[model samples]
Target: MNIKPLFDRVVVESVQSEEKTKSGFILPSSAQEKPQTARVVAVGPGGVVDGKDVTMEVKIGDVVLYAKYSGSEFKVDGKEFTILRQSDILAIVE
Candidate 1:
């Protein structure tokens, strides 16, 4: 499905939580916390800042880390996604 965000909004697909810890300890789905990292799926062209177009620092396919409580959640085609402003993103992963 194609998704286009508007005015600085970004669509992200959250990375799935790990089923096991680094030490090999298994974790149930209910015991896992939602992952705060995600990949950028779609992005708005730009946002108006003092009437000028300000482009986003991130682009589609960029993996980024964000605050745990950031963004609003929704589903598209039965898949979950998050809509967050650029400011909510903390850092881009290499």
Candidate 2:
């Protein structure tokens, strides 16, 4: 299945979170935090949003950092995805 975001929304997939500490201690799933980094799978077309001229800065395949609890989550074809506004993205990983 393919995803296409509308307006300034973007679809991203989470990267795997670290399950172990740097000290070689393994962390349990209950101790894991929500992953804030994700890979852009699809992006919306840049255009007028909420009466403002919005432009998209990130494109598909870009790795980005977002707020810890931002965006909505969903699943497609057994894979998880998140849909968030462009502004929710904090930085693009170079």
Candidate 3:
């Protein structure tokens, strides 16, 4: 399955969460926090959107940090993904 965003939208997948804490305490699945970081899966063409000339700052394969509870989540081929606007992406990880 191919996911292509439109008009400054971005598709990303959550990075894996830590199973153990730095103190060597193991965390269970229910205790794990949601991952704020994700890898870019696909990007939309930056055309005019919402009366603004949007230029895409993110590209495919970029790692990014987003709001804790942003975007819509879906699954494709048993893999999870999130779709959000470019503005929702906070920063790109170098």
Please identify which of the two predictions, 1 or 3, would achieve the higher TM-score against the true structure: 3
RMSD of each: 1.7, 0.8, 0.7
List the candidates' TM-scores in order: 0.89, 0.96, 0.96
Candidate 2 weakest ten by summed lDDT: 27-36
lDDT of each candidate versus the true structure: 0.91, 0.96, 0.94
lDDT of 2 by residue, 1-94 (tens): 8898999999999999999999999999899999999999999997999999999999999999999889999999999999999999999999
Q: What residue runs in model 2 are displaced by over 4 Å at the alpha carbon?
A: none
Q: Per-residue alpha-carbon lDDT of model 1 for 1-94, expressed as tens digits?
A: 8889988888999988779999999999889999999999999988695687778999989999998898999999999999998889999999
1 or 2, greater by TM-score: 2
Q: Residues 30-81, candidate 3: write the lDDT tens digits.
A: 9998899999999999989989999999999999999988999999999999
Candidate 3: C-alpha lDDT: 0.94
Model 1, 12: alpha-carbon shift in Å?
0.3
